[model samples]
Target: MNKPFADKLRKIASYVPGEQPQCAGRIKLNANENPYPPSPRVAAALRDFDAATLAFYPDANAHRLKNALAAQNGLKASQVFVGNGSDDVLALAFQSFFCSDQPILYPDITYSFYPVWCGLFRVPYETVPLGADFRVNPRAFDRRSGGVLLPNPNAPTGIGEPLALLEDILRHNADCVVIIDEAYVDFGAESAVSLLPKYENLLIVQTASKSRSLAGLRVGWAFGSETLIGTLEAVKNSYNSYTLDAVAIEAAAASVEDDAYFRKTCKQVMDTREASAEALRALGFSILPSQANFLFATHPQKNAAELFEALRAQNIFVRYFDLPRIDNYLRITVGTDAQMARLTDALKTILS
Candidate 1:
């Protein structure tokens, strides 16, 4: 450990990302990354791109990407903000909107990054507990909080709360910002974007990483009122002017323009998610009804830690968090049919 670090930095408990294994014949379902390739237009754009622009700095504002995103979401460019990824967008949001004496609110079992961001930004936060069924209780969020943030089709649990309940939470907390991270929205979950016009304080953050199959490119955005978007831009400019590179801007625009391919890939993942859930349930696992591309499941008779290790031994990886309440569960990403079939076969052998 390095000496004389900032006391706050030393106290911060960093977030642990899913493993990225480099092994032969690995079936990776650990991270909720899309199994499909990015839109062919992305490659076409890259191929046709002029390398000469690489000599100059990329656009600081990323106007083209923001405009495309705004057009796709039926909003103006002024109401859109893009970042390196949704993680960056989220960090900016934490810094911009959550600077209050009151504590921010999020689900106890929501995205692990929430707490990490709060700590990094020095924002006080309180975690509202999810219900016994692993669903959010929106009423618990009616308190006077600095802000509210939670992922739709909530991570690790992969269960989505209805828009009505989400609206109820937004209604109660109209004075503060409510960030609905729809990172997996395209999988099957209804986006809170529909409620954006009604609630000015609402911000819906999404990523091209999952549905658009551009994780490596790291593009993400947020849609909200012009006022909210302006705040994020202010924070972003203060943080990093050239957050996204030129290639990423062009590729993201191309991907968003090719709506057909995006829909096809998202539908494929959702279809595979449903089938995989059924397969896990048939294997004596209690799988959550997931609207995301991943499933949260636990077996009644088998130990989750053992299963996670066993799957890893067979070169098949899934996400397992040894946290309280969810220590018994495994969050499995939906891979291709063949990949999932291999996972199923591997599980059958483990169970037998």
Candidate 2:
């Protein structure tokens, strides 16, 4: 066998997702999954779906789901693009818009997949450092580049940048595409979707995975000018015509339409996040004010690495990055109140 893989893939360090442990009794907070079940409507929609539809290829365009998303976001159907997940949406966007000789710009501590996409597509990229407070300084993006992408409530840090600052970046990079990954926007962060009319270069990607509890369905979408959306659709079709399956399109549509359930679930998670932050603070953790379904915190007296192991041994799971600046911190997903209570109790025992 003559090394079947391509030369580019052989040299790439692939993106590593959080561990999905199989322990039945463990509290899973490492992947930022929603604790609540998806809306009752999602279940009903799935039940109502015709099984024979699976016998045929899913609608390559996913027009119905796109219409639902557009209605939810108050945008026209032409301004929305759907993908298997935010990851797929982002990867397609990277392929569609970032091909210039200049390097794409992103935060040094953003979703780890950014660099992986850059490598896979062979697009050059430059990482701008987050400020000492672990927030993206949008002003730093005022430079010539192929494109820009950053999470609103950035992962690992969970701190959301203000919309005003994001606008400044968009203003400076008007000629280039500015991708805003808003996976956690429904939790509390201000969505840039509202600014879509003002900045044609801006593309905002969102997911049903977080707020809608549809991670398992693998449905994500983006909002932007019709031209940007058309480009994404073209790129996605070139790769996979049926990007979203029948089950996912129906589930996501139901989730989007159930506004009351969505708002209630989001409030529950946000409430739990605040309560968990206070509990961690009482344990001597220096917590950041997060607008997402998770918290990023560091302890004054405890070693994050050792604490992570201790929690794991107790069947509690939280994400601890071994990267620079954040090695000392832990990113904990807000789970059900019971799960969070177990985590706090375990931490109390470990710290004592």
Provide the lowest-lDDT 10-residue window in model 2: 3-12
The whole-model lDDT of each prediction reads 0.92, 0.92
What ranges in model 2 sit over 4 Å off?
Answer: 1-9
Clashing pairs in 1: none
Residue-level lDDT tens digits of model 1 in 1-352: 7656566544779999999999999999999999989999999999999999999999998999998988888889998999999999999998889989999999999899998988888899999999999888888998998999978989988888889989999999998999999999888888888898899999999999999999999999999999999999888888589999999999999999999999998889988888888888899999988989899999999999999999999999999999999999999999999999999999999999
**Residues 248-271, model 2: lDDT tens digits:** 988898888899999999999999
Name the 10 consecutive residues with the lowest summed lDDT in model 1: 1-10
lDDT measured at residue 241 in model 1 versus the true structure, 0 to 100: 90
- Model 1 misplaced regions, further than 4 Å: 1-10
| TM-score against truth, every candidate | 0.97, 0.97
